[model samples]
Target: MSNLDQARVASRSTETTRAALIKAATSVFAEYGYDGGSVRLITQRAMANQAAVNYHFGGKDGLYREVLIAATRAFEENAFLDPEELDALSPEDALRRYLHQFLLPLVKRDRVSRFLRIFAWESVQPSEVFSAFIANSPPRIFRLAERVVRRFLPHDASAEAVTFAMLWLAQQPMFFVRDAERLAQPPFSLKFDEDALERLVDTLAGLSLRGLSGV
Candidate 1:
């Protein structure tokens, strides 16, 4: 092979390896979690040797971080607004957008299942590593939510009120994914399709805004 051709081949091989590792890591981490997911199992799953983890990802912790990042990939898309754009938005508009953005992570059915199932496991039987991960890696959208929500709060908004509002909003997506069938029954028989869920964002935003604005 020519020098350039050989370099291209090497680059493709590297990309392939990294993608394999991330895919393997996602499954293994989802199955076993950070504490139980060993480097050995991950390497075996990826069909690579142990050293590949260190070479590509630095170490197991780094690999796990990448796995978490992949899990959240959907959420990160279109998650940021230019500061100027956000500053120009009215508080109600900002809160409405923020609430809609918050649920984007669960937009895909598979992503929703994996995310909820993995986190359910983590929360029920969390390890020290899980605690550290939560403590260190607050989702970026959370700060955005708080910033907009604060606009409607009194100067001395109860800290718990702010947190409570967030938790209540959080429950909507959880219920949509977790109790989907229950939601689709006789009296409450609501469509849980993507469009329906998207519409849900507007409903929630309106209800939440009224309460927050004391309308």
Candidate 2:
């Protein structure tokens, strides 16, 4: 092969290894979390050399960081609605629409469970990486959500109240996203097909409005 051909081959190989390492790391971290997940396990799953991670991502920490950044990116793309979309709606409509959009991430067919896994990791064993990742992520609709909620809350409403309400709203989707398998079976035996999801989202939105507005 000519020098140019050799370089092209090397580039392709590097891209392949990097992609594999990232994919493997996501599954490992989701399964074992950042602390328990090992470079060896990631590399084995990726079917790349162990040294490939060090070469591409610098180390386990770097690999884990990349994995989460990727997951968070996917989550944002699937979850957040544009704040501009709420501009034309009344506060009540905005709040209802916002809650519905927030839950949309949980309904993503492929990444919902993985995103839930990442959030669970954040809650259980947060690290500098998680903190930094959250800090740097672009403004989510949460800011708009806060504004919408504030319009209905009492004048004495504290930041804590708003945050608590948001977290409470989040739990509904989190349960469905994280516990779908169990939630699908047994005494609950709930379904989440199209009609069911719509009803659930509408119910959550209504409950959120009533609670926030003190209605």
lDDT of 2 by residue, 1-215 (tens): 99999999999999999999998877776666677778888889999988898899788878877877777677567654656667778877877776665455345545545655656555557777777876877234335556666667777877799887655654545555545666779999987766677788788777777777662
* lDDT (CA) per prediction: 0.65, 0.69
Per-residue CA lDDT of model 1 for 1-215, tens digit only, reads 89999999999998898889887777676556667778888889889888888999898878877766665564465334443455589977776666555454345445434554345346446666556766877544444555666777777878888876655544544444444555679889876556875788888877887777772
Give TM-scores for every candidate, taking all chains together and pairing residue i with residue i.
0.58, 0.74
State which candidate has the highest TM-score: 2
Model 2 clashes, total count: 0
* Candidate number with greatest lDDT: 2
- Residue 11 Cα positional deviation in candidate 1, in Å, after optimal superposition: 7.5
Which ten residues in a row are the worst by lDDT in model 1? 74-83
Runs in model 2 deviating more than 4 A are 27-45, 71-80, 105-107, 110-117, 120-128, 138-144, 154-157
Ten contiguous residues with the weakest lDDT in model 2: 138-147
Q: Which sections of candidate 1 miss by over 4 Å?
A: 1-15, 24-61, 69-84, 105-130, 158-164, 167-171, 174-191
TM-score of 1: 0.58
